[model samples]
Target chain A: MAKNKRDGTFYINPYLGGVLLGLVLFGTYYITGRGLGASGAVKSSVVSAVHTIAPVHAEGNKYYSKFLSDDASPMSNWLVFEVIGVIVGGFLSGTLYGRLKFIVEHSPKITGRTRLIAALAGGILFGVGSQFARGCTSGAALSGMAVLSASGIITMMAIFGSAYLFSWIFKKLWI
Target chain B: MVGPLIPMGVIPETWNNVIALLLGVGFGFSLEASGFSSSRKIMGTFFGYDFVVLRVFFTAAITAMTGIFYFDYMGWMDASMLYINPYYVMSAIIGGIIMGFGFALGGFCPGTSFTGVAIGKIDAMFFSGGLFIGVFIFSELYPLFQGLYNSHNLGGAKIYELLGMRDTVFAFLLIVVAVGMFYGAAFVEKKVTKVEY
Candidate 1:
């Protein structure tokens, strides 16, 4: 029988999973003197693509220019490398768990088209939001909370608080 | 040698990217193994039918925090050297709200979305593509939001300092709160109707 993702017991114990994730985070700090990040890779990719397409335009932009440097390519970002590894690791887990099928996951109430549109909208907002907060949930919230940073704590509160309220509003999206 | 061995020159600088890749492997494996690759599983936290996200997230936070604290106390690592995200009060709050909005709609964060893509979820691919476009839009419109983005900067502020609590005291309280949430989450999960994805 295929293991259902929703079953609380199908996956690794939450506490154990947390410890593994926490250890990875702790290791990240110990080794890199930094936390893990996700959205940053997207930032780097955007900068690199822009820089490649229009050097002058990219350099002229205040936001993109901040990442421009003569000595290094924005594509050589640490987060980019880490994200590649994330793909490999996720693949490994999916293989082990038999979740390697190509599919669109959605609530029965919604069509796949609806899920796609919502996913796209959500991703865009997250991209825009992470730039403002200077980090995403992983970088600012989880990583920050590990160090007990004021901004991280505040961002965590705001993200969860807002999401909790909105989830209710978007009740049909999930169930 | 200090714990942040790379900066301390205990580890060669050339290995930086290599280590990043390694750390990411562990990070991804943990998230996926924990069922984070599934959007429905993650959305469960908000729905009250499942508290896995809360359990995993808080447990991870406290676990790492505890490790850092103990390591710092032991003089095994220089916690002060760790990169603290700057507190841009207004921006952090506003940005977090926006990200939260995205979270509810998409059912995935940037990190989790990647894992979903790795597992071949089509919706995750759309989400990831949208991230690129969204970032591009933000960069193009940077001039308009620059003021709001950079406003109210507090440099590397710690939560304990902001809250007027000792570091140890705050850490202890966080642990207590996380544990309480775990229990409360279980209570809520039991009460709510389960939804099959």
Candidate 2:
């Protein structure tokens, strides 16, 4: 079987990758007056979809209504467009580096089904957490840290701290 | 002229979305290039085999923090206009802890998962589907969680203010800390038994 192009070997130096990521983040803040975000776009999409299908239900909800406005669809917001660019930019990078492929990435110890199940469950938890926190890792934690926000610092520490313990419990799943 | 472009009008409002797309391109390119698109590579941090997450995250944070301070000193941008994450102390920490567990299990955050999707990872696609479902769930249940979510508001508080330190001092300390962690990551990567993914 052919190996996954991105999985087989050679990754760029970590520090160089860091520098590049830093520059991107800095650029994001400089231009937008805000940092990069990912989960918010998904939240917006969900709100839009819910509103479309069940406007009454959406309007009745406290969470969905905060994002809704009479002048514009929540789905048409900046984060949504930025997320679209993320897909495009990521694809371009993969193509450029020969890293695009179809495969299920998992620990050798687990079946693809198990990995997928875990992935789904994890995503759900992340989704809920991000909504409550007002942002996900990229949006709340990382971006917040960039501006030295107190919330950002707290979130960053909590995430790494919690994940360290959780990762140990799930050791068999990864290593 | 010490920070945000849009609010300060250093850049016009019309360019916001356009610049957002361009900035996102840069953001996506960086994440993909850093191997964030791969679940195994991302999970490597938790396993002690790879520390890319720590490296990229801290470096980016410290770099941007320093740059913002520098720009403020130089009067290139208005730092005050930039958005800071509001400090809802309990909610932020609790939410982070939950997100952390999700990350350890799922191996992809929302942004990286999108990158994974771009590279045709069906698992990422599923993860994103789950994200939407989870968001919907949260929205529906917002009344139950609203109190916790909005609790203990600190109103865009800064770490420097909290610590009663000069902004530059805080920023410098962060750089030093990031550098130390980078070295630590290198050391650990060398010591750990190599896990081929």
Candidate 3:
């Protein structure tokens, strides 16, 4: 494995990583009958928070009410558990690779503060977009594509296409 | 035996969450090991410096799709029982555009960002906080976006059905297209000067 001089951690080959990911995804569908997701877990957390802080308000809202259930806590959802596992899994990988550290990763051209702001703003946009698209890159686009769903293909195209277009526009932030 | 064990009642419902946790571990480990925990590395696809995202994503998609098809053919699993995301023409495109903008700026998707958070990236934390706020805003103002959100509903439509092709045929073509893209990405990576993150 080739190590990065700065980080001292070696990254896996991309194609090999992809195959592993694909097998995981395949296994997920085989066992659970659904694809992997990330945004849904975040949505579940948001719903749980709102329900806790303002039950009346959460119940009053159509969108929030849809997720509010009497049987189980929103935080008790499968996606939530899955997200927790994601954190654990990520930590394990970091430990194995010696990539565990506290730092703001950014390009040299930009200040850490600038990078943080961009990350926040971008996350906000993704949050809003995931709702409209009904899923983010993983849930809607990738998972959807795996099943040959029209929604997944279209969303995937739109995401990559728009990102390619906007990357050129937001070139200063990155390159 | 029919597949989709949980949905088909082959796997007990009590084990659902446990399975979710195990699967998520795999999902997270794969993403992080692929260097998806880094925003700059993820952004490489857009910059022509690296095509890891393209390679991983397409490869995953095709591999899963192929697996499902094979399972269905062999009568090992019932593919029809699988869940499919509904198509809302306008919202999917519009939402995807917004996410694309976010990707350009933030450089990490929700899944990847969580992996970043695990590695102690402060920026990922803020980005996740922003996700909560964004979802809150969207919820609070759901009425304003309701019309567009519910406008076009094509319920669980398959790509092959829409294009008038058989699933096997479409899957084969997709594999071909994915292979082509992989080759193209390799070519592009060689031609472009590498940008060290």
TM-score of 1: 0.96
lDDT of 1 by residue, B1-197 (tens): 77888767788878888898899999999999898988889999998987888988999999999999999999999999999999989999999999999999998999989999998999999999888988999999999999999888989999999888999999999999999999999899889999887
Highest DockQ among the candidates is held by which one?
Answer: 1
Model 1, docking class: high
C-alpha TM-scores of all predictions: 0.96, 0.95, 0.96
Better of 1 and 2 by TM-score: 1
- Output DockQ, candidate 3: 0.82
lDDT of 1 by residue, A1-175 (tens): 3656433336788899999999999999998888989999999999989999999999999888898863184224889999998988898888877778889999999999999999999999999988988888899999999999998899999988899899989989887
Per-residue lDDT over B1-197 for candidate 3, one digit per residue giving the tens place of the 0 to 100 score = 67888888888888888888898899999998888898889889998998999999998899899899999989999999888999998999999999999889899899999999998989888888888888888888999999999988989999999999998899999999999999999999999999887
Estimate, for each residue in B16-129, the C-alpha lDDT of model 2 and write its tens digit.
677778877888888888889988888888778989888888878888877777787788877788888889988999999999898888889999999889988878887887
Local lDDT at B102 for model 2: 85
> In Å, what is the interface RMSD of model 2?
1.2
Please give, for residues A54-105, the per-residue lDDT of candidate 2 as tens digits. Answer: 9998888888888887318322478888998899889988887777888888
Question: What is the DockQ (computed on Cα atoms) for candidate 1?
Answer: 0.83
Q: What share of the true interface contacts does each candidate keep?
A: 0.87, 0.77, 0.84
Off by over 4 Å in 1: A1-9, A70-76
User: What stretches of model 3 exceed 4 Å from their correct place?
Assistant: A1-8, A70-76
